[model samples]
Target: MNLPPMIAALRHHKAAVTLIALQVALTCAIVCNAIFLIASHAQRLHVSSGIEDDALVWARSSGLRRGDGADARARADLDALRHLPGVTAVAQVNTLPLMGNDWSADLGVTAGDAQPAVNGAALFLGTPSFLGTLGVRLVEGRDFHADEYVDYSPFDDTPAPPTAIVTRQLAAHLWPGQPALGQRVYIGAGSSQGALVVGVVADVARSAISGGTSDHDVLLLPVRTVAGPYALRVDPTHRDEVLRTLPAALIAQDADRIVTDREAFVDTVHRYFHDDRAMVWLLVTVVGSLLLVTALGILGLSSYWVHQRRRHIGVRRALGATRRSILTYFLAENMLVVGLGLAIGTCVAMWLNHWLGERYEVPRLPLSWLGIGALLLWAIGLVAVFGPARRAAAQPPMWVIRQ
Candidate 1:
C-alpha cells in the first residue's frame, strides 16, 4: 500500500512516464474546450427568436419600385394581403428575426458629444402593423398610433421616425432600474432630434452583425419601409395554404414585380443557423474521438509495463502476494501518473481558454469542466488498466520463473 516504492520504480522509466503525462495533459486541454464549444452551439440553436414562429409567414418584392410608385404599391399590396382568408394581421418591415439582413445602429441616452452606451443593435423600420404581424409581446408602453406612422424611402428624402419601440433587453441596458417609457434616445451621433421610446417588447432575436453582441438588442421605428418583406400572421394550420397562393393574391393587387416565394418564418431561422448546426456536430465528433484515443493509449501503456515487470511480479507472488494486491499495484501506479497529468492539464486548459477568448471571443472555460475531465479520465484509466492488471495477476509464479 506504500506509494514510495511504486513511485521509485516509476522514476527508473522517466521518459515513458513523462510522455504519457504530457499526452494526457494535451488531450485534456483540447477536449475540454471542444466540449465547451459544443455546449455553446447547442444553446444557440435553442435560443428564442421571440417571434410567432409557427403562425407567421413572409414574402418580399411583391411589387417594389425604386422611386415614386413604391409607396403606392406597398399600400395596395398591404390592403390585399390583409384580406386573405387565413391572414389575421399583415405588415411590411425592413427585416425579421434570423433573416440574415444586417442593419445596425448606435444609440444612447443623450444626443451630445459622448460615446453611446448601446451599440450594434439591430435597427428595424416597420409600420403600425409590424408589432401585430410579428407577434412580439409588448411588455410595457403602447403601440404606435396610425398617425404616428410615416413614409420612408432609402433612395429619397426620408424623415426620422417620430416614435420607436425597443426590446426589453435593450431597454433594461439603456435605462436600468427605471421606466423606459417616454425616454428619448439619439439615433445617431449628434442628432439633435431624439426618437422617443413609446413601447418595450419582451424580446426579439437578431441576425449576426459586424460586432458580436447579444441578439436581443432590437429597435422598431414607425417608418414604413418602401422596400421590405410583408410579414403575415396567419393560423398555424394555414401556413402551407398561405404560402401556396400568396403570389397570385399579390398579383391581384398590381404589386407583382419580382415576387419571391413566400416562406414560413421558422424556415428562415433554420437557414440562418446552418453553420452553427454543422459546427456543433463537428465538435461532438472531435470530443468522442479524443476520449477513445486516450483510453486506448492508457490500455497499451499498462499492458507494456506489465510485460516488462513480469519477473518482479512473479517474485512478489512467490512471496505470497495475493492476486488482488498485484492488480491494486498496477491501478495505483496508473492513477499516480494520471493525477499528475490532470494537475498540469488544469493550468493548460485555462491558458488555452484565454487564448481562444482573445482570438475568437470564446467565453471563459468553466471550472466545473476540469473536474469533469479529471473524473472521466480517472474512470477511463481504471477500466483500461484493469484488463492488463488481471492478465498479469492470472500468470502463475512457476510459469513466470521458468520464462
Candidate 2:
C-alpha cells in the first residue's frame, strides 16, 4: 500500500510495465490524430459548393450514333430534353464543377511589357448559357456572346483570340499591379486563338465543397472549341420523374441517339471522395483496435499484480484497511503508469507527425491533440484498472493467510 514499496514492485516487472506503457502511449497518439483527420475531411465535405447541389440532375452521353450524324443527332436529343416536363434550362458543357472532371489549361497573358507566364489553373469552360445553367455569377466581364463563339474576324489576321473573361483570383494572380480588363491572354497552341479578358467574375466554385481556395482564373469559351461531358440541372422533386422520362424525351426527337441515364449532383460529388473517405474510416478502425489491445494489456498486468501480492493485500486488509483502500491502491498505481506513458508518448507522437507530414498531406500534430491524447490515456488507464481493483477487493484476508 505504501508508495515506495509499490514503485519497487513495478521495477521488478519493468519489462512488462514498459510494454504496457508503450502500448498506451502509441494508441493515444495514433487515435488522436486519426480522429482529427477524419474531422477535417468531414468539414471539407460538408462545405457548400455555393451552387444548388440538390434539385439538379446530370447525365453523360458519348459516342456517335453511327458517327455519320453525331452532332445533329446529339443536338436534337438535347433540344428535345430541354422541352421535357420538369426540364429547366439545358446547356452542354465539357465538364461540371466539383464533379472533378475539370478541364484545366494554362493562360498566357500578353501585357505590353509583362511576358506571358503559365502560372494558374483555370477550373471552368463552357458555352454562353453554361453560366446561367450552373448559376454562376458574372461580376465584371460579359458572358460569351453567340458572335464570339463563331467569329474568327479578329484572330483571322492576328495570332490571338479576341476575348476572354477570368475570375477575380485569376485576375490578381496574372496582373496584380493593374486591372485585367482589356488584357490579352493566350489559351491554346500558337497563341492563335487568343482570349481577351473582357470581364472579371466574382469567383466560380467548381464543386459543392471547396478546400478554402476560391481562387480560379477561369477562361470561358464557346463549347464549340471544347470537347467534354455536359450537365443538365433538374428539379429535385421531379428527379425520379425526369429520369424515367428523359430517354423517352430524347428518343421522341432522335430515336437513333443515346440518351444515357440521369444522376443526382450529390451522387456525383460523393463518388469523387468515396475512396478517400473509405481509407480514413479504415485508419480509424485500426487505431480503435490498437487502443482495445492496449486496454487489455493494462488489465492483464493489473490482474497479475493483485494475484502476486495476495499476501501483501491480505496483510493490509487484516491491519484495519477497508476493501476500498486496497482497491484505491492498485488503481492509483495504474494511473501513475498511464501518466508516465503519456509523458513519454508526447515525444513519440511528434516523431510520428514528422514522418506523417513528410509522406502524407496531413498537417503536423497540433498542441491540442497532445493534451487531449494524454487525457484519453488517463481515462483508459482508469477503466482498465477497474477490473483488477474489484477482484482485489473481493479476496478475504484469510485467503492470503492460508497461502
Candidate 3:
C-alpha cells in the first residue's frame, strides 16, 4: 500500500508497462483521427446539390447504338410525357448535369485588349431555359435571350462569337466586373469559337453529391428542337400516377419503345453519397472495436498482476492496511499508467492534425475533447484495474504468514 513500494514495482516492470502504454496511445490517436476525418467527409457528402432535385425526375434515353432509329422514338416519347398529367416542365438535353456522364471541355476568354489564353473549363451545351429550369440564379448580366441561343454565326470579321452566359467565378477571372454583357469571350482553343457574354450567373453547382466541382463555367445555348433523354419535374403526390401514365402515354405513341422511370433526382443524388456518408458510422465501429480490445488487454494484464501480488496484498493486510487502501493503491497505479498513455496520444494526435491541415481544411480538435478523453481513459483504467483490486482486498492474514 506504500507509495514508494508501488512506484518501485512500476519501475521494475518499466519495459512492459511502456510497451502497453505505447500501444494504448497509438490506438487512441488513430481512432480519434479516423473519427474526425470520417466526420468531415460525412459533412461534405450531405451538402446540398443546389437545385430543385426533389420535384425533378430524370430519364436518359441515349441513342447509344450506331445509326439506330431509336433517337426518333426517344424524342417522340419525350413529347408524349410532356402532355402527361402532373408534368410541370420537361426538357431534353444532349447531356444532363450530375447524372454521372457529362460533356465537359476547356474554354478561353479574350477580354478587351488581352489576347485569348485558355484558363477555364465549363460544362458546355444547353438551351436558353436550362438556367431557369435548373433554378440557377443570375447575379449579373442577363440570361440568354431566346434569339441569342438561336442566332447563327455572325458573318462579320469580329473576333468573338454571338452569345453565352458565364459563371461569377469565370467573370471575375476574366473581366473583373468591367461590364461583361457587351464584352466578347471566345470559347475553345486554337480555332476558339466566339460566344458573346450575355449574362454573369452565380456559381454553378454539382449535379450530385460526388461531383468534383461546381458547374461554374457553363456556356448554354438554346436549340429549336432538342434530342432525346428528357428530365421532368412532377408533383410528388402524383408521382405514382405520373410514372404509371408516362409509360402508357409512351406506349400509345410507339409500341416498339419502352419507357423507364426512377424516383426524383434528389433521391438519385442521395444514393451517390451513400458510401461516403456512412464513413462516420464505419469509424464509430472501428473505434469501438479498438476500445474493446484495449479494455480486454488491460483486464487480462490486471488479472495477472493480482496473481503475482497475492503475497504482497496479504502482507499489507496483516500489517493493518485496510481493504480500501489496497484497492486505492492499485487503482492509482493504473490511472498513472493511463495518464501517461493519454499524454503521448494527445501529442501524436496534434501532429496528425498538422499533417491533415497540409492536405485539407480540417478543423482543429476542441479543448473539450481533452477533458473528455482524459475522463474516458480514467474510466477504462478503473475498469481494467477493478478485478485486481477486488482480488487483493479478498486476501487473508493467514495467507500473508504462510507466504
Top candidate (lDDT): 1
Better of 1 and 3 by lDDT: 1
Quote the lDDT for 10 in model 2: 82
lDDT accuracy of residue 165 in candidate 3: 74
lDDT of 1 at 63: 56
**Local distance difference test scores for all models:** 0.83, 0.68, 0.64
- Roughly what TM-score does model 1 have, to 2 decimal places? 0.90
List, residue by residue over 2-77, the lDDT tens digit for candidate 3: 6687789889777657865886787667666766667667766656544576666766432322246544654566
Q: Report the Cα lDDT for residue 155, model 2.
A: 25
Candidate 1 total steric clashes: 1
Question: How high is the lDDT of residue 294 in model 1?
Answer: 84
Which sections of candidate 1 miss by over 4 Å?
152-159, 209-213, 254-256, 394-403
Q: Which runs of model 2 end up more than 4 angstroms from their true locations? A: 1-6, 64-77, 106-120, 137-225, 248-261, 317-328, 390-403
The sequence of per-residue lDDT tens digits that candidate 2 reaches over residues 1-403 is 5789878878987877798788877887787777667666776655444445675666655442324665566576567778767878666666665677555555665533234465335545554466667666777767777666532222235343356777776777777888988887776434544567787776665533335453344556554333445456677788778878766766576555575646777787678778568867887788678778888888888888777878888888899888898888888888878877887788888887788879885676788888877787788889988988888787888987677
Better of 2 and 3 by TM-score: 2
lDDT minimum window of 10 residues, candidate 1: 151-160
* Per-residue accuracy of model 1 over 1-403 as CA lDDT, tens digit each: 7989999999987876887788788888888888888888887888788988999999986357647776777788888888888999999888888888867877778877367778767787787688888988998999998888887533344556788899998888888898999998766655566779999998888866322355788888887554678999999898899888888778877743667657898998888778889999998888888878888888888888888888999999999999999999988999999888888988999999999999989988899887888788888878988999998998999787667
Q: What TM-score against the true fold does each predicted structure earn?
A: 0.90, 0.75, 0.68
Which of candidates 1 and 2 is the stronger one according to lDDT? 1
